[model samples]
Target chain A: MISIIIMNKTAADIFDEYLAAKGLRQTNQRRQILDAFISVKSHCTIADLYDVLKKKDPSIGFATVHRNLRLLCEAGLAQEIKIGSGKARFELTFGQSHHDHLICLKCGKFIEVFDMQIERLQEKLAEANDFLPRKHKLEIYGYCRQCR
Target chain B: MISIIIMNKTAADIFDEYLAAKGLRQTNQRRQILDAFISVKSHCTIADLYDVLKKKDPSIGFATVHRNLRLLCEAGLAQEIKIGSGKARFELTFGQSHHDHLICLKCGKFIEVFDMQIERLQEKLAEANDFLPRKHKLEIYGYCRQCR
Candidate 1:
């Protein structure tokens, strides 16, 4: 629990540094959005984030939340996950290791997963094709245990 | 060369069946679009496909091309790949075995790749999480040899 708090603090520091580098202001609203985003443990759509923000501060408009989410993505503090035809979901990236997702089609659950073997093989596959690999996105979609 | 032609023909047949099942007319324009789409070996944006279609048939509008591409996705003949902040690219899916992609960030080139070990491990990971996996998408982005 203490580690999680430290992680969130580290994420906020990273975002602040990113904003400073871009000459962007660190507004109270942006801080609020980031806090709400970090508090949620699952991948969330913009609407999902907006809903949470709306409850806490009714004055915050949807568009502001949307723009801030994109800023967060640009800062590398968050990453967007697009699944099938669904709305793009943003998941926290800062202070997190590289991992893929197992998304539940029925309940919208996201299971973060990582495998050293899969990672090595991906690198090998890219190397075989003469590519200097940078990053990868792997998402497996299906029904979770209860949903199935 | 002969095998590629056979594959394109099978794709067209499958698309025709899909259009018929949806109670949609198999228009000449859509056929032309499909042909252009399948002929291109790399993943292409709508603008890329539109450029080819417009050169061949000036009457085909961009909206028609965009609509048809979405239809192709729904029909399982193509899949949309969103990489970074770039425009989404559509690649042919029909008459092809399951494979991932190695995308060149510099030149926008795509290399089709498959590995049995990665596939098996993905299934194992999903099963371990109690997920009934339906499908997966893995895209590795980097610089190809020439670009590097």
Candidate 2:
């Protein structure tokens, strides 16, 4: 169990290493924003974030929260999702393991899912089109079980 | 070849059918806009569209163009692509079936590529999560061959 845990990388480790490579100082602001993201595990718009961060630390300005989120997105530490909503939401990005999103239109909830078959199919289709596919995001919009 | 072409759904035919279904008149402006889309072979922004449509018919209004485009999107005759570019682009939904996009950041050129593998994988993932996936769009950002 210890060996397995050691081999696995936590979201924090990935983010810290990314910052180190980019010569970006692990600032308290960044740490706070990152912690907020991990704690609020759902699609969160910038405005939603500003409101939440303001409650936790009144000293943190809206601009600070916004800037940190953008930085996280640019550094590949997070994903900006547009789930048919006008505003963009951010989520933590895990290495090569990427999953598609199932968005509930009614409740505005997002559920993550992964399918190997679809991934392989995309590769084959890309090959036929002479396209060197790199990264792809698949988001499906629908209602959840409770909503349905 | 003619018979086969008739058997398969043409883009314009699909557009006309959708328009009729929605009780939208096949107006000169709408026809012109649809023709402009069919004439071009790539993703287009509303500004890009206004440029083309204005040449064909100088009297067309931007509002009409915008309204018709929205109608087309709602009718499923066209697709609305939102890249991180801030402004959204529209493309006539072709009979080529559903596919993803490869957007060249440097040149601002976009290419459509189909990947069945990725689609299947997403479906499986959605099922596992008990999330009913409805639709998906993948936009990959990178430099194209020409731009590279």
Candidate 3:
């Protein structure tokens, strides 16, 4: 819990820095959205995040949440993940190590996972193709243990 | 070239089977769209595919192209890939071995690659977490050799 709080603080600071770099103001609504996003700690669609935000402050409009989430992505504090043809989901990226996702097709649950061997092999594959790899996304779609 | 033609023929057969199973009539428009999709041989956005299609048959409307692409996906002959927050792109999946993508961030080129060892590791990872893994997508974004 302490670590998560620390990470959230850092995430806010990073967002502030990003805003400053882009000459964007640090608005109250953006802060609230960011706080709500960090608190969720799971893959959240725009609707999912808006529900959480609406509970705290009814004035927070859906468009506000939508736009701010895109800003957060541009700030490198969040990532947009698309599963199949569904609506996109946003997951916090700041202070998180590189990981893949195991998504439950039935329940829409996301299991963040990492494997060293897989990472190494990916690096080797990139080198073989002479690609200067930047990042990667791996999503395995199926049933989770509970669903199975 | 001959092999590609054979694979395309099989893809059309599979789509015909799928449509029959679903009680959907095989329309001439759907057949034209599928042929255009199979001939592209690269990741293409809806707009890209529509452009190729319009050149062959100028009467083909964008909405028709879009709807049939969705049908192609449902028929399991195509896959949709989303890179970042941009437009969705479709790729051929039939008659191909399981593979991942190396996408060039600069030129938007896609290199389909498969590594047996990486595939093995993914299976192990899914089993470790008690996941009943189905299909998986791995996309690495980078500067390709030419871009580099």
Candidate 4:
């Protein structure tokens, strides 16, 4: 199993390189959005992000939040999850250590887990179909332990 | 590894039970819809379903297809996939044979793969977060083998 690690300096440097490759400007809004995202560690809707940005700086609009999110998603800085709900949620992308979500139906809690057995099965299935695997998102919806 | 096998009478029996559980009347329209769904052999939007139904039986209204699709989803007879697209496509739901999609950007071809590694990782993710796994969908957007 791959051990989970903190976002170290090397990761940050690589993130900068990713930004440059995407031709994205390292602007104040982008930094603020990323800060708010990291600080608020949970699945967040576009409106939720907008609300958080509003709390920090009153001038940020919903469009900005949506646009920055698309940028972040395009730059491989974040992942978007649609949990059969009304709106989609965005979270930062964690490379290598791939996991899926256990989403709380009521309180909207997200639990991330990593299992190697499932991963091997996925590869085998892909190969059987002659598919070239790329990125994938697996989200499981249910009540959390506390909720249950 | 769980081997893929023919979907036999047991599958249809289960689907029938699901229909009963959902209090849906097993009408000719329902049977025709199921047959049409199974015969299409591709991920389809409601519009696509309607078109197919129209070709076979012109009497079926668009609203009927929509309503039946909703019922099919409620009865767990079908799976709905939302790939950041405005509308949703659906396919018949099989058992725990996990799969992901390789979607074509141009032609909208959805190739399914059962990746055990991803499934296991998803389970571990849910376990780590104390989340009970209920349902999951993994869609990886990219060109298919032929498209690539």
TM-score of chain B of each: 0.87, 0.83, 0.88, 0.79
Q: What DockQ does every candidate get? A: 0.72, 0.44, 0.79, 0.48
Of candidates 4 and 3, the better by lDDT: 3
lDDT of 4 by residue, B1-148 (tens): 1222346553456557787886766787877777787667656889999998899799998888888877777766677778773688887765434466766665667776665556666666777777777767766655566866
lDDT digits (tens) for residues A1-148 of candidate 3: 1125353467778889899999999998998898889888668999999999899899889999999999999998898887777788898887788789999999988898999889989999999999999999899988999999
RMSD list, candidates in order: 3.4, 4.6, 3.1, 5.9
Off by over 4 Å in 1: A1-9, A17-25, A61-63, B1-9, B19-24
lDDT of 3 at A118: 93
**Which residue segments of model 2 deviate by more than 4 Å?**
A1-28, A94-97, A127-130, B1-26, B105-108, B115-122, B140-148
- Tens-digit per-residue lDDT, B1-148, candidate 3: 1124453467778888899999999987888888888888657889998998888889989999999898888988888887776888888877766689999999988898999999888888999999999989899999999998
- Better by TM-score, candidate 3 or 1: 3
Best by TM-score: 3
Error of 2 at B143 (Å): 5.1
lDDT score for residue B37 of model 2: 68
Question: TM-score for chain A of every candidate model?
Answer: 0.87, 0.81, 0.89, 0.80
Better model by DockQ: candidate 1 vs candidate 3: 3
lDDT of 1 by residue, A4-38 (tens): 44544677788888999999999989999998998
Q: What is the lDDT of residue B48 in candidate 4?
A: 95
TM-score of each: 0.82, 0.77, 0.85, 0.74
**Which candidate has the highest DockQ of all?**
3
Query: Which lDDT tens digits does candidate 4 get at residues A1-148?
Result: 1223456543345456678987766777877777677666657888998898898799987888898888777766677777774798888774435676667888877777655666666656656666666656666787898896
* TM-score winner, 3 or 4: 3
